[model samples]
Target: MIRPSGRTDSRLLWPIAIHPFTGTVEVVFQHLKRSPPLDDEPLRRELMTKLNEIEGVDLAEAKLDLRPSFPVEVFAEHSEEICAVPEWFAHTVALAEARRMPDGDPGTY
Candidate 1:
């Protein structure tokens, strides 16, 4: 069983899940750890948009499905949504991450 903390933080985060074979992407927006979580669909979409733009190709927009977390005692976590990401979303994310890294970083060692 999966357990959630039911707590949130100021730093918003989302995990990008991709299908290795199908190339399908699903982003999970979770609650923060320092503060409480709110049903912030607009915030989620806004952040997602920034990431999606990296694809640089006109593709299908994300279809948000609002689903708040369940009971605290059971599963205390923010809701998640499944969206159709561009076919090149994965490559775009990789490029974006790589660009942020320096030409000489400890990870290179």
Candidate 2:
């Protein structure tokens, strides 16, 4: 949910997801429509190296996934391709809010 801002603030963004329990890190390549320099392996490796320097991050276990700019509603009726979740939009938003909510309950906090 982080956005980069700068003079060169291209619409491109890299969404990094870190799982607290399993320690799985995912980098979703959502802005493929825009030219992102990380598509280059060298740059990706360099960034991964820097990220791995942190105590808990392991670049080796990192997973790469794509989050297309297309609306989730469009994929709701899709039957051929298997979605990551049974319900994509609700599940995705719930997952995000769950991560944001410390006690797992947004209302309580």
Candidate 3:
């Protein structure tokens, strides 16, 4: 949400999200492009291996989209650049507002 000061909050819920599928151990689950990223395959493997050793559960049917995302919040406070990430929602919202339509025009939605 954009605040009264015109800055938008850009925090993600978590670093990563896990999904499970059918079968034994399918590695990982597919995530949307906008999801927060953990991006740790080796760590996941280690944890999964440990989990298997500890619980003896099969996890072969998983499909992982291990990815890393660099949020603008990391640099929001450090640099003069307000929105470092051009594609970020905050940045895009700002751009849209900048090009705002005139009142009673019913511009393309």
The candidate, 1 or 3, that scores higher on lDDT is 1
Candidates sorted by lDDT, best first: 2, 1, 3
- Stretches off by above 4 angstroms in model 1 are 1-5, 9-13, 29-38, 56-62, 66-109
**Which of 1 and 2 is the better model by lDDT?**
2
Q: After superposition, how far is residue 43 of candidate 2 from its true place, in Å?
A: 0.6
* Candidate 3 TM-score, true structure as reference: 0.25
Can you give the lDDT of residue 53 in candidate 2? 49
Q: For every model in order, what is the number of clashing pairs?
A: 7, 0, 13
lDDT of 2 by residue, 1-109 (tens): 2224211122224434445565344545433223334444454455445444444444453332243122233233443332332233234344544665567655543
The lDDT of model 3 is 0.33
Which residue pairs show backbone clashes in model 2? none
Q: C-alpha displacement of 100 in model 3, angstroms?
A: 36
Tens digits of per-residue lDDT, candidate 3, 1-109, equal 3344433223432223333332222223233222212223553444344333322333341433443222333333433332232234334333434454345232222
Residues 1-100 of candidate 1 have per-residue lDDT tens digits of: 1115332222233434444465334444443111122134554555456444543222234343322221221111212222233323334434444554
TM-score of decoy 1: 0.35
